[model samples]
Target chain A: MPAANGNNAGILKSGHDARLLSRSNKCGNTSGLAPGYVQTNLIVLPSRYASDFRLLCARNTVPCPLVAESATPGHWGKIKSHLLGIDGETLAKGLDIRRDAPKYNVYVDGKLHRQDCEDIVTEWTDDHVAFLIGCSFSFETALADAGLTPTHTARGRNVPMYRTTLPLCAAGVFRDSTYVVSMRSYPASEVERVRDITRPFASTHGEPVAWGWDALERLGIRDIDSPQWGDAPLAKIDGKPLSSFKNNEAEVPVFWGCGVTPQEAVMRANLEGVVMAHSPGHMILLDTLDVETIRKF
Target chain B: MPAANGNNAGILKSGHDARLLSRSNKCGNTSGLAPGYVQTNLIVLPSRYASDFRLLCARNTVPCPLVAESATPGHWGKIKSHLLGIDGETLAKGLDIRRDAPKYNVYVDGKLHRQDCEDIVTEWTDDHVAFLIGCSFSFETALADAGLTPTHTARGRNVPMYRTTLPLCAAGVFRDSTYVVSMRSYPASEVERVRDITRPFASTHGEPVAWGWDALERLGIRDIDSPQWGDAPLAKIDGKPLSSFKNNEAEVPVFWGCGVTPQEAVMRANLEGVVMAHSPGHMILLDTLDVETIRKF
Candidate 1:
């Protein structure tokens, strides 16, 4: 049996076990919790917009690589290799999706309505479809194992994300949106190796799409310290923005397609419907191995 | 300009030109016509069944790798780089999808209403959505260029396809269907080379799923000479069913996911709504190259 710590008793020793730890400890971040297992971004939309959302993910594969999805409107456990359901070998008995995650963000008519909640069982409906998107957390373990921990991870801060000038390929009613990218600065010399390490994780945004400070200007980033979501870099010497660390001389910021892009697109589309997502940094841990998640079918 | 041997004029010297050639010559097989351009399988379903079909394609990507789709109901050429309308450069001034293909197969309520027809204009409705699935014809050119021509192409016969025991992952009302695979035979020594050559064209069912005579038994294939669709192998020596060839001493049978699979599933589902598809050897030729078709976002 895999070792379990914190509140976890039956689950594998992973970021998932740590997430259970966070839930009991009143901590919200699920990032860096499950190491080898896949972590997924969550988005629940009404069945009316499900097809369009599916099309959106297919068109924008890099930013929105679908991991598993609800087979029917009301079905949650139908994901073939799920972690939190009864049909497959589940993490817990009698699992309820609405109450499982560390935190939830509720949106009404595409506007942020609730910031953080322990559970959203009252908000969910029978006509809702849940989508699981592979998250950057799935690939961070590989990067760390290769001795290239992301700068944000090393500094104990959430990864910085920015909206880019790159427009997404439109699908159906989902339209008029730009890609959102997460940034992690690395030594300029190690950029190629960093790309190589992350290249196989295509389901997790694959390799960095842009590199260096020039990329910041190209992607229209005015400041590196202030992100659209998540905590800022650790060091801000005398009110001046630096990299994630205090001494950031050799680092160059690299950008990867962010999981927040679909939510951003949903908010921009402004559809007259409710969409729910996991709070930023709070993701759903899955049973699938990271290698299995990236395998070509 | 590329050479145009058959009745092709004004069109670029590629699949588009051959489709024009087939249009005039009343020819159905587009097996060896265009060398570099992409060829696609066609399936048109009512908008009511469109979402389920899209999900089906997503779940069973190997057999139903979607190349392009109608932007909306009743639209034909909204694909970003299409070959059938005015928005982008198209084949003819006013291309009608109903009358374009060399032959059409009309299925009414999951029953074959017509085997072959020059045009499907009489059966078309405004609510239909057209789907273009990438076909193996897109990658055969590369195999030939690598000096590993498939036996079906060498003998000028339509590729033999079989219904396999491999059950497709179900989605929505589309259920209870098995995978359809097309077979080609080559020397045992060249299987790896063949796999290498076709691996890049993932949209067109990259690489064989099974190989050798044992694969036939594993897939529950009782007969190799008699197939569900397309012409039988060119020769059957001594009335013995050979491996897509006569002398089977060194030949090894290789199976690829067939584009005809979605149609098989539709037929099995026994959907009340009629679905339309191109006749087996008559495909829709697109303007995009095989390389462009396989490119990731």
Candidate 2:
């Protein structure tokens, strides 16, 4: 890994730059790393599970906005963006999917067999199909552009995610899984504006699924500090717990359908063999801009 | 049939009002009838052709935005709109689909078997599934709201439609069919404004697929006044042939993906059974407002 305090301070210039940086680095969280680019959540499953998983995405689009997928099993050189007629580079070329993301998770029989592996080239086989699912990071540029910076971004941590009671519409062999969401606390006054700003990014998660503390609890999120995936919300900036930040009444927690929902659903399936996914916060960056993903309204 | 010179002069107050009128009147064109409601192109095929047809829509979204489909074959109680999380009347309820549209068309062996039939409830079967395709009429309200009225609407005639050389993305048996488009003319100076106003209704065929008189001929159109479907453009509105209107250097034709493209594709499929569609100028009115369909940005 590069030195902790050098010119490569987290953020990179573009998607192409980020990909080059990612190929050389050890596994790390990808949040706030590549701005204004389409970052995707990766899921690799056998051809047997591909149809069922596709149905799962179609039935539950909010939590799983299907972006691109392997045209055929083991064929991963190029994939087309599902969004039509957008004027931009829809194809990501000349990269290794096995090592493009900063980190990866390998699940065997519904259990985590390997966590944060740098690459999975050896594990890949001809039966494998890679699905590039849309990530919330694709719309973060809009949020930042609107001046509603996410609390996690301000604190330099991964977004906090939670499991919820929202049941997913099931498909064959993929049944009985609840929804998952990521939280971003913004000033209470900005909730409507936040929803309005993010509303056009439908290819991503679009608008907030829930907006207040009670709404979050109603969805079965019991704790605000703890998260099911990614890093816990950082309470301190310099060295002390953020007593003032935690008690700020003007701030409210907003939730959007998280990419973790699909990952969790695949894990719950517990297929006969193994499936692959991006480790929490490590996403595949596409060449397209975040604005290009916005619905043209 | 109600007298054409009565209080109801083409337009109705609301969706409920329009439906009540539609029920009592003999088959007629629906152009400019219901001012602000969503209208749809209807298509019904056997369950055997449903999956492939669905893929066809998913692939060619610009030409075929699948709004809603029968939940099960011949089961048409309710359909959740494909659009995600818009706060509006997304559900169409309690209406008999077979008799609702102003006129119906029956097809057999890829040929027009009947035209302008009032209803086809007797021909309905449990094996058939209905698809409600988005109509360009959904975005016409935005055009009028922006002070750019459609030429066909102003002249009180059906929009001119043409079969084009642009081929659709083939799916299963539904192959080798070219595209069909609806044409509307506006002042040459207003093309940009027209494009901007209608860009939001992505569920409808978003914006103009092409904008200019040359684009019409390039798509293999020999006569702008004559159309393959719907009424021929009435060049002479008041008196004399529209030599003046035709020569007006300011006006130009704009083309959009017409609902006819999918209907044409289904016909070309020539499945060994009957197919049903809304007649050329007739449409099914939905209980949602026109603005509700606009992709929020």
Candidate 3:
């Protein structure tokens, strides 16, 4: 069993055991686990909805980039291997998927119902299928590596997310929905560098879809007061905001694709059966590194 | 038929006829036809050797990228569609596989007999399969667009090629062959710019595999004389050796993987049958744009 430290260093020490820990519920939030390793958003659905979902992913690749798909029906281990590279022997080894996640949000008919890992397993059906979409955390690490600290990471915020006007391509039961974007602040000068660095991380949302000071306002976001998830980053200069003045050298906000797109799609589908996902900040830590994952296919 | 002239004006003037013209062998070389479109290098082999060849391509992606494989046995058109995005209807409408190339080199038992296109159709076997790898023309155009003209293009010579000491990863019959590299000379100042521009052209051999003047000589390519493929570039400025006469300026030589790797591999396989390829300069123009092809996959 791997220790549940929520940092990249701790994740690296755990190695393959981290996957087991994630499956076993021994490890907690995957926010910082398996540093430099690729983490993916999970989406499992019935076989009937697979083709449409595949098309959906293809059309909206930026948000829901399809890394790999299940090879056959009822072959959970193979599908998991395609995504996590876990073999049958490993699957037979038995993983505690339910307890690993700190929390799991269950959706029924597009409505959210809190369910721990154990409850979800009972909902699983023989026809259920899954998808592992790319997440922004990989690219965020890249940004941090480049010496630009993402505001959310520094402040321990959830990373502010917004529903944007950019509509997704509709596929079968998956209807068009505004893309969800997560924002982080940085010095204006770092935006281009950030863009260039993130461009190559295509599997992890690639480059930003939009950028500008008024972008939030354009998207009908007002006040910037209330945030949907995570704490709002404090705009400060030299570790402090002026008591009665605006600072000109504060960080500027930038946004990237969040991994919630497919989850949102799954929720919208309102399918009768079950769908599976990693709990918030809890990801299946694979043996594959981010660069290797990008290079393999 | 498409005009043989290079650039968009020629493509616009030729339109759909370009396809027919390419097939008619009216276009001497597919180099300039369908500007902005991708041009592919073709390789065909029997199914018995398909897996080996596929592995070979995967191993030596820079030189023998496996863009598309036959979806099933006896389905040549399906492979073409996947690679060129041309529909089955378009292919059935009629494609003169034979005589399509301005020229085709027939190889048997690892030796080139003569350059001709007639052998393609008669050579086709029920078990034969084909692959379309990327060519350098696309990258050359991209470099030119970025204001970095390749010296070979400017000097009106085939890109200088040499078999290097660098051994490509072997797969099956493709083993122990040195990488064939195309060299271009650029000022030291432009090295970074050239690297930046060419790195994205991964399908077109990506960035240079190596750099340096004597780097080739160290690889056992001692004689700068007795050129391999193209005319020798001018090495003297005002009767003084160019490399040494430049005062304080430095000139660096760069090398890229040549398209000849696959052709070389086919010949080395010594398989008894017909193998098809676009003539030295002739190529299969694809509907995909260069940018899209090179875009981060």
User: Residue-pair clashes per candidate, as listed?
Assistant: 2, 0, 9
Model 2, span B99-148: residue lDDT tens: 77877888876678888887768667898888888889888878887878
Q: Of 2 and 3, which scores higher on lDDT?
A: 2
lDDT of 1 by residue, A192-234 (tens): 7887778667677766766777767656787877888876654
lDDT accuracy of residue B249 in candidate 1: 42
Candidate 3 clash pair list: A7-A32, A23-A96, A25-A99, A25-A100, A30-A281, A44-A130, A45-A129, B1-B21, B2-B18
> B236 in model 2: Cα distance from truth in Å?
65
Positional deviation of B139 in candidate 2, in angstroms?
Answer: 30
The deviation in Å at residue B207 for candidate 3 is 37
Each candidate's TM vs. the true structure? 0.51, 0.52, 0.49
Model 2 has a DockQ score of: 0.02
The C-alpha local distance difference test score for the whole of candidate 3 amounts to 0.59
Q: Candidate order by lDDT, highest to lowest? A: 2, 1, 3
Specify the highest-lDDT model's number.
Answer: 2
Candidate 1 docks at the CAPRI level of incorrect
Two-chain DockQ for model 1 = 0.02
Error of 3 at B112 (Å): 45
Off by over 4 Å in 2: A1-10, A86-89, A234-249, B1-297
Task: Provide the lDDT at A139 for model 2.
Answer: 75
